[model samples]
Target: MHRRDFLTFSGLGVAGLMLPHARLVAAEELLAPADVARQKLLADTVLAAAHKAGASYCDVRIGRYLNQAIVTREDRVENVVNSESAGVGIRVIVNGAWGFAAAHRTTPEGLATAVGNAVAIARANSKIQSRPVQLAPQKGVGEVSWRTPLKRNAMAVPVKDKVELLLSVNAAAINAGADFINSQLFLVNEQKYFASSDGSWIDQDVHRIWLPFTATAIDKASGKFRTRAGLSAPMGMGYEFLDADPSGRYELPGGVVGYGRSYDPVADAIAAAKQAREKIKAPSVKPGKYDLVLDPSNLFLTIHENVGHPLELDRVLGYEANYAGTSFATLDKRESGFRWGSDIVNFFADKTQPGSLGAVGYDDEGVKTKQWDLVRDGILVNYMATRDEVHLLGEDASHGCSYADSWSSVQFQRMANVSLAPGRAPLTPHEMVKDVENGIYILGRGSYSIDQQRYNAQFGGQLYYQIKDGKIAGMVEDAAYQIRTPEFWNACSAICDERDFRLGGSFFDGKGQPSQVSAVSHGAATTRFNGINIINTARSLG
Candidate 1:
């Protein structure tokens, strides 16, 4: 098989996992106004049945999920697919224990049966319960609807247009000296309706899109190969994200362009081809302790792994240890004033930030989403908590972090849009890098590994630039950094201002026993960490 063909098949396979199931329906059948009304009715029926079946509290989620993927290589379209999945999931508390059930059929009888099954499961589980679940108080916000404010709904866009875009992107990479290129555009639409016993009936129309591609430049003579990935991020926006914005674009210090709300895939592909070609000849780094300057693309994943995952209240309390692993940021660690970062470093977990993957008006459990401080003045101040987890931290409200990933999955504590606050005083990436005598500047996440406790870890990036005499010397390769979580964050360094802030996100962050995927974003300015251990990965391999 051709390399591009193999990549296209692999891309489709991953997209299948992302959407889970692809039950195809006519566009009108799946998206008509009547369908939404029917979903709301199904949710109402489930809630009513749960209450009648001796349940104290109940909520139902009726969802219609749509996904489209277009894959291309050079000037050829490999695959174009459209799939949909619709179902209703019901949850209830009976005898103080939680139970949940789901059904693909959206009929009134099917929903009622699902709700009854949930109540029965709750009662059975209560027989062996350690204690009744204590849920934090939440006042219901009456009937409401929230839609992602989008200039263009990706679902409404033509597949031909999407295919043309990917083909152009591939051509750009190949024209810029790429030996091989594979590009794909994935679009998702989640039409959800929620109704609960707490007098809340919420409906939401959510949209998300991701454009990812790999550009490889190979040297068959020396047998060396290097690849650069798309700098674009998965966003909770629409097709409009692909629109170019000259005014909003930032000129990065290292001659790279940084995108804000919009992206230019053709330009990024052109740059990726050049970068990958150069990477084949980039010098390998010499291992030593040197200050590290991190671009937002690189720092977002570090923040996700070290800060976002560790601070999930369920992870810290060991509720997720079986699958997702426990956290080192335990209750005692927070109480003892553990410094999670430098005094200048601050972090916030929010679901209210526009354009972030985690942004939603309300979480799955009907709690209104809001922002809160996670790290304050270098201290571990709070953890991401759902309604059930908040009371353990002596909090009276949920952090609105509960999410289910799909209608069939049970809701649980999930990460929010955790972000590092930019420097209060004026600063820029150039200014932050100028003071470093001997250092490395890293961009884009490459590979990473962390212990079960999310404490000790090592990270590598897509591009590394050697800094000598307070200037970017040249590109470097085979560089990775090792650190203990607290020690790593406490290195006390400068951060660029909000003008330099940007978001990077994950489309398939997995958790739980059945392992559902959640999309989340982490935002940060270009930041510095001082005197970190830089290892030569190639040297170690030898």
Candidate 2:
């Protein structure tokens, strides 16, 4: 389990933060790469042991996962940590059944024992197996390496520098008249090595970063409070993500600062404080059907739940039912050419897009990654599939969606960066707004609810504006939109072009029985959905 699983930060000390899978490490170790020759040598030993024990196929993953979190509130630094986990997981097919074992030990004897257990488990499970496992054919590249193109490694940056940045960000919020604020920076590095009996030797170094914070404003006289959150997106980049690149900033209407490839947290905090104060007196929505204009920050989560999760082949095939429920987009629906959206709607599943969390050269299972269509011209075309699941789709090659959160976790089909395609014609959010008659413009993610099947849902946003007669009238509060999955996508009438495109994502998207978190990104331009149901949340509460 990750640190987020059971972390209660109220009174925990540094020792308490450590898990068996992760331990506090020296700062220098964070930048150090694991030895490749030694990892292959260790893997070869495990493979030979599995083969000797009646295995037909074998693979090993040796991973070094590193993470750093710095949390601050108001004027004080709450916690700072640098942790690392290093281990190996071996999987084998014995008697046509899959088995797996993991160990922290890199010694040959320890790996041999893990191999013995894996083969034995597979042999026992084969007796009751429904059928032999089928994996699509894969030709491995003998030796290859890939790394996240980086200018500076965040982990290598001084702790003092990061802390000072956070402190300054908090001060900015306070100076703008915020009652309270919380800010945090999360950085992760995954150094992974994969070896298999199929002659594949692969190595990958991945980096991801996120800086999130909330600013609150209170009206002491009215006993009311409102908040605004930072617009920064978690990204697959180096420390440069925090830089205040003016070219990367989007000054949306109402003076709301929208971040793209880079962010300025200090500036965002200043804006957030001012926005939160304005939210206090913002008028309540006069709930009714209205066109909705959704910024990427707010639309990304919607795409993640309604589109990304439901189209996983594992979910549609019923092999996965733990993340709330299985998918409604079943095989028959996909094969029958289900209309998922308007002719203008296009969505793709990509794992190779630069600066995306899921942008890896190869998946954990050693398949070369690439982009493919999930929905093309509004028709359901495919589901995200791995080497083990591609046979269900009658495909010979994997979509390369396979991933394991850590060395000890079993590899499985995970969502990639599923994103909406931009409009072919030149368009911008400003131009798109001019065409609207009556609509609500929503920015950033807020409270959301979706059904177990990921069908019916309601979504809220951090900032909302009423658009009347082709213009933003002013701010509004307690606004949300309701949707039926198909109706929602089909309602997509207009989408801004690439110039307005931006990425937003979750750093910890949890799925499975023993839930594992995977970081994923979703990109979209400003988009418009017609005649959606709007709800007055305050009415429901009262």
Candidate 3:
């Protein structure tokens, strides 16, 4: 739904440039915090109505969402959009069945009607009920608010400033030898209020921003093309991410640079242009087994698909079977302590990590947010869960992973900010690379494919370098690696220490039947996998 450059630029494979959303929101129209007393009263009305209608439980979400997008190509501004959406969604459990209704009207009468409709629907469903809903106990922390610790609200920044930043970034790419460039800035602000019959009234102010672009290089004589995308990761911060800090940048092996607390899109665009041009002439990869060094940018998506999605209890329990498909990490496998990775592999689902997209005071279902392990010491330990799904795993409380893309959408279990813990040994990517004689250093996300169970998969990246004699030899193209999920993680021989950790994520990770988009982050230090099956995609294509 995001607006993006119309110019067709290919070669990224499956990881195409992210377009701006179609919705727009004016800055001034963004809703300010509503009076806490007033919102609680509104929620009380809905709760009272639901209880009167024979409901066992009820919750309400009132949300104000603001979005702004600035898109530019080459020397011209392509588009600018601003828009807002506000609504309330009511959910209730009646006769042991769940039902939901939403309305844009904020009036007490309107909410009461919506609650009535939800109860009616639940009753109708209960006629054919299989079993009653079983939700884990949640002791709500009454009446609280959480806000993103933003120094500068992106909504307060002028649209002119955003447009200027995009234009400047495009110019940098063009000046760096890109034949064509497309850049965009996306900003979001969400003001949400939640109230549930469990005696919890919570409010939250959330902000997120992404500056993404694609740079292309073409060889007119050969009629060949190549492209590279900006290395900047979409952040949970505000416009402050635009201001580069010297301390935040990390110098990696092979002259590769990684950002920490902030990013510099202009610098990334310049590098992207150079990398794309080099890609046009980079030698085709020679197919064979090789030690694969995956940068965080490239590895995040792999973890998202193969690890994050598969660990969702809903997916494993067969309650969710849409979009990307069900999980292979079933309860039997987890209970048996299946060896999912190497001893160095420890993956956890965290919703409280600072600056994480999933960080929040509580989940949409009013459960307190916390961190829990999915895999520990390379063994499957747990799965992501919501209030309703945790009981399947014998857990007493939700893993706090419930989410809804909008106020009008029904809340459901979603993936949290799952991450691979860093190596305890004080290792570094540069140090790890020195030990590799024959390997491929892969950076940034590229085209990828995974099976329904998230078992078998192939992955590509923005850049690939051949390593020989403990040094980066040169660039290579059309390189990809294939692996089965368990085998892939078991092959993880090395992971860099915390000093090199960085976050990589998608602003729009789509899942579910109605396909709601959720933002999630995955953090890892540079990692090495042994003897991965490297293939020459270009030769195979021809």
**Deviation in Å, model 1, residue 88 alpha carbon:** 0.7
Model 2 ranges off by over 4 Å? 1-20
Tens-digit lDDT track of model 2 for 380-423: 99999988789889899999989999998889999999999999
Off by over 4 Å in 1: 1-21, 25-36
lDDT of 1 at 370: 98
User: Candidate 1 residues 361-447, lDDT tens each?
Assistant: 999999999999999999998999999889999899999999987889899999999999998989988888789999999988887
Among all candidates shown, the one with the greatest TM-score:
2
User: Using Cα atoms with residue i matched to residue i, what is each candidate's TM-score against the true structure?
Assistant: 0.96, 0.97, 0.95
Q: What is the per-residue lDDT of model 3 for residues 1-542, given as tens digits with 9 covering 90 to 100? A: 12222232112211222222223445566545556677777788888998998999999998777777677789988676667777788999998899999877878778878988999999998889999899898886889999888988887888778888888889999899999998878777777899999989999988888888899999999989999988778878888988877787889777877787798888888889999999999999999999999999899989998999999888897767655678889899987889999999999999988787788888899988999999999999999999987888887889999999888889999999999999999998989999998999999888887899999999999999999977999999999999999999999999999998899887877778776778888999999999999999988789
lDDT of model 3 at position 376: 95
RMSD of candidates 1 onward, in order: 2.6, 2.0, 3.3
Residue ranges of candidate 3 with Cα displaced over 4 Å: 1-25
Better of 2 and 3 by TM-score: 2
Total colliding residue pairs, candidate 1: 0
